[model samples]
Target: MAEPAPRGITSADLEAVPAPLVAEILDGVLETHPRPRHAMAAGELAGELIPPFAPPFARGRGGPGGWVFMIEPELHFGPQVVVPDLAGWRRGRLPAEPATPFVETPPDWACAILSPSKARLDRGPKRRIYAEAGVAHLWLLDPADGELEAFALTEGRWLLVGTVRRGEMVALAPYDAVPFPLDALFPLDAPAAPTET
Candidate 1:
C-alpha cells in the first residue's frame, strides 16, 4: 500500500508560532526558524532604495519616484505566505492603500536577506514560489559574503542578471534608474571573505 499523505498546512499555523520566531509555509509544510541576529543589509538596502524609488514625497528628490516599498510585508500568493526582507510595487499597480494587513497581489520586486537557516529555503522553495506567481524580479543580498545577486523572471524561470560584491557601484535592470554602491549595504568593518585559488 502507498504511504499516507501529510496533512495540508495553512496561514493559521504560522500565526500560532511563538513570538520572535518567523514562520513560513513551503511546499505544503509549515516551518519556523529563529530570526537572524541582525539584518544590516536589509535595513541598509531599504535606506538606499526608498529615498529614490518610493513615493509619498520622493517626486522632487530627483530620482524616479514611481514605486512603493515595504519592509517584511506578509505576502499571500495562494496558500503560500511569504514575508520578503524587502518588497516593492509599481505605483500604478498599487495605486491605493491595501485593504488588509497582508497583500495577495504579487509585488514587482522582492529581495531576500539570506540568513544561515533561511538561505536554503529562500533559494529553493521560496524562489520557486515567486517564479510560479510571476514576480518580475528577485534579489538575494548576503551580508556575510557582502554580495548582491539580481535575477529576472524570464521564460518562466529566474535568469541571473547581475552580481555585485562589496565596494562596487551597480546600475541594474528594472531599477536601473539610479546607480548605487554595494558598499552602502554591507558594513565597512566586516572581515573580508576568503579568496578562492
Candidate 2:
C-alpha cells in the first residue's frame, strides 16, 4: 500500500515555535528565519518614509500623509502567512488599527530586504502570495549590492516598475511624493549597482 500523505502545517504550529526565531506560514508550510540583530539600513528606509508618508507628521512635514507603516508585520492571507520587512496600508483602507494579533488585510505596498537565507522565499513564494493577495506594489532591496526594484501588480501579475541603484535618487511609487537618495540607505562601502539574484 502507498504511504499516507503528510499533514499540512497550521497556525498552532507557527505559534508554538520559540521566540528569537521569526516564523511565518508560507504556502501552508511553517517557515522560520533568524531575527537579525540589526536591520541593516532597513530602519533608515523607514525613518525616511515614515515622517513624510505615515502620520503624526506627514502633511505637517510637507508630504502626502495617508499611510500606516508596519515593521515585520505578520500578515495573513487566507491560508498563507508571510512577513515582509516593511509593509504599508493606506489610512483610508485601514482607518483603525487592527485589534488582532496578526493583520489579515493585505498591505497596499510591501518591501523586502534580501537576506542570503531568505532571498529564495522572498523572490518566489512570497511574491506569488503578494500578487495573489492583490497587493498593489512590491519592492525588493539588496543592500549588500545597493539596488532597489519596484514592481506593480497588473492584470494579476507583477510588472517591473523601476530599479533605483545606489547613488541615484528615487521617486518610485506608491510613496514617490518624496524623492530620496538610494545611497542614504546603504553603507559607504556598498557595491555600485546590483543584478537580480
Candidate 3:
C-alpha cells in the first residue's frame, strides 16, 4: 500500500499544517494582494542598504551590502498573517531570484512601519516574531510620530540602541557608515510651527 500523506498535509486542509507549508501560503497571499502603505517607507529605506563599514562583520560574496527584502510571512503566532513592512537577509543567505513573494527564510533584519491599520501588529506580536526568529536587527518606523527606533539582538535579547526623532542622525548596526537623518523617514515636508510667534 502507498504511504499516507504526512499527517495534516493536504491541498484543502488549512488547519494544523507544517511550518514550511504555512510559509508557502503566506507568500502567495502577499504576492497577490495589493501592496500596503508601509511599502513606500520600506522602498525609501532600501536606498540605504549598502556595504557594512564596521569591523568583525560577516561579509557576503555579493559585496558588503546585504539583500534587503520585503516579506509577508505566515508566522504561527496567532490567527492573523503578520506581513512586515520590510526585511533583509545577508546576501549569501538570500533565496534564488524569482522565488515568488514570500521567501521561506527569516531575514537578518526586519522593519515594520506603523500605519493606522497596522499599529498594533507592528508593535506587538510581529515584534515578538522577529525576535524569536533571531533577527539580528530590527527597525520600527513610526511615520506619524516621525520617529525611528532601532534595536539589535544581543545575547538573544532585543536591545534598544537608539530612538531617533526629528533632526537626529542615527547610525544603524551591521552597517555603521550608512547614517540616516530621522527627518528623512518622516513624510512631512514642513517643520512644526513655532510656539508663540
Candidate 4:
C-alpha cells in the first residue's frame, strides 16, 4: 500500500513551532521555510536600499517612522498566513501602530528574495496568495542572479511591469520616487586574481 499524505496543518500548528523556525501556510498545509544565507543577506540589502527614498514615512530599522516597512512580517489572509522577505504598508492605510503580531491589513508592497530552494514556491503559491490578498505591488529579487522583476496588480491579476538585470538601473513601482540600481541589492566580492603559471 502507498504511504498516506500528511495531515493538513493549520496556523495553530505553526504557532506551536519554536520562534526561531519559520513557517508558511499553503493550500491549508503548513510548511517550514527557512531563509538561506544569501536570502537573509538579500533581505538586509533590500532593507538598506528601500529606506532612504521612503523617508517621512516610517519604515523599520532606524525608527518606526511612518509606513510599516518590515522584513519577514507575518501576514494573515483568511486561512492562509505567509511571511514574505519584506513587506510594507502606507501610513494612510494603517494610521496608528500595528497592535497585532500578525498583520491582516495586507501590504501595499511585498518583496520576495528568491533562493534556489524557494524560487518555485515563491513564484507559484506565494505569488498567488499575494494576488488573492490584493497586494498592490510585488517584487521578485533573485540574489544569485542579481535580477529583479516588478509586478503590479491589475484587474485582480498580477502583470509584469518591468525587469532589471544585473548592473542595470530601473525604478520599481510603489517606491519609484527615485531610480534604484539593481547591483545594489547584490554586491559582488572581488574575483581572486589569476595565478602566474
Candidate 5:
C-alpha cells in the first residue's frame, strides 16, 4: 500500500525547495505537486483578465469599485500558508495593506486556475481550506476544458452560482460587475487559413 499523505504541509518543508518551484502548505502538510504543461500559460492568461477591471475595482479609480485584486498572493491563515492563482478583497474590509509579506485575513474572493496536475488538490483540499477560511466567493478556471465555475459560500458550504464554457461570455460574482469572455481567458493556437474554393 502507498504511504499515507502527510497530515499537513509546513513552511519548513518548503524551505529547502528552490524558488522556481510552486508549493503550498495545505492543511499541515507540504505539497509539492507536479506542474501541468499549461499551468504557466493559464497563470499568464489570468493576469490579462484583470487589467480591464483594475482601473475600476482594483485601484478604486472609478466605477462601482471597492475591491483589490491580486495575483498569486501569499496568504497565511493560522499555521497554513496557501497561495491562490488570484485573490481579491473588499477595500472597506482591508483599508490598508498588511505590513507582513503574507496577509492573515482570508480574501473575500479567490480564483484558482486548474491544471491536470493540480486539479485534485485545488478542487478537494484547497476548496475545503478556502471554505474554512470564510471566503465568500470562489472561481475555478479549467484551461483544458475552457470552463469557469463560480460559487458562493452559503453557511460555509459552496453553492454553484454559474459556469461559463469556452466561447461564452459570462458575468459571475463577485467580479460580475463586468462580463468575462471565456475564450479570452484561454487563447487559441492560431487563426486557420481560408480554404480555396
Candidate 6:
C-alpha cells in the first residue's frame, strides 16, 4: 500500500525546493481547490449584482502604458512559500507572465483575508513581505472582526492610512472616490434592536 501523506510540511522543506517547483505545486493545488471566498467576492462584485462602483479587474490589466493584475501570488519569504490571498501589480513592475497561474512578481497591492488556518502568517510575516516589496497599498480584512485596515507605503515604510470598523464609513486610498459602508462587508443580517426593561 502507498504511504500516507505527511501531516505537515516544514518551512525548511519549502525553502530547500526551487521556486519553480513551488509554483508548480501551488498551481496544481490551487487548480483543484475551490476557493469559495474568492468566488463569492468576485461574483458579488460582478454584473451589478452588488453596489455600484468601478468594475473590479482580476489578475491585473495590460495596456500600452502598463498593466495591472489581481493575482494569487506565491512568495518565498524566509523559509515559507506564501500564497497571499490576493495581489495586484502594475505591468511595468511585473515579471513576464509564466505558463503557470502563480506569478513570481510582487504586486502593487496585496490583500489578505483572515483565516483561522493562516491568520498569523497573514497578519505578521506577510505584512512585512509586502512592505519590503514596496507595495503601495495593503488591505488586511478580518472577516471575523468585520473590520478593514488600510496601509500605505511611505518612504519605503508602511503607514496606517485608516481602519474601518463595522457600521463605520470610510474611503479607501488609491480609490478614494469609492465610498464603502463598513457594515456592508459583514453578513447580511438585521441590526439588533434596543431592549428596554
Candidate No. with top lDDT: 2
lDDT of 3 at 58: 22
What's model 1's lDDT at 70? 87
- Show pairs that collide, candidate 6: 59-69, 59-70, 60-68, 60-69, 60-70, 61-68, 67-91
Minimum summed lDDT over a 10-residue window in model 1 is located at: 1-10
Compared with the true structure, what per-residue lDDT tens digits does model 6 show for residues 1-197? 11222335444443554443322122112111223253333332222111232223321322122335453566543333456666656656764665644455566677776656556556775677677766789887776676778899999878999987667664776544446555555545443232333
lDDT tens digits by residue: candidate 3, 18-60 = 4332221231222112244655556656545533421123263
Error of 5 at 118 (Å): 0.8
Clashing pairs in 3: none
State TM-scores per candidate. Answer: 0.88, 0.89, 0.64, 0.80, 0.80, 0.59
The clash number for model 4 is: 4
Candidate 2 lDDT over 26-87, as tens digits, reads: 76567777875339677988988999999888867789888999999999998888889999
Q: lDDT of all the models against the reference?
A: 0.81, 0.85, 0.57, 0.73, 0.72, 0.53
- Off by more than 4 A, model 6: 1-67, 75-80, 91-97, 191-197
lDDT of 5 by residue, 1-197 (tens): 11223655445555655676667776666666554466554565555445545445345433356667777777887766678888888877677888876788899999888887778888998898999999999889887776789999999899999987766676888766656466665555432233343
Q: What does candidate 4's lDDT look like per residue over 93-124, in tens digits?
A: 86665687888889999988888767877899
Ordering by TM-score: 2, 1, 4, 5, 3, 6
Cα-based RMSD of candidate 3: 8.9
List all candidate RMSDs to the true structure: 4.3, 4.6, 8.9, 6.2, 5.1, 8.7
Q: Which sections of candidate 4 miss by over 4 Å?
A: 1-11, 39-44, 47-50, 53-66, 188-197
Off by over 4 Å in 5: 1-13, 34-62, 189-197
Q: How far is candidate 5 from the true structure (C-alpha RMSD, Å)?
A: 5.1
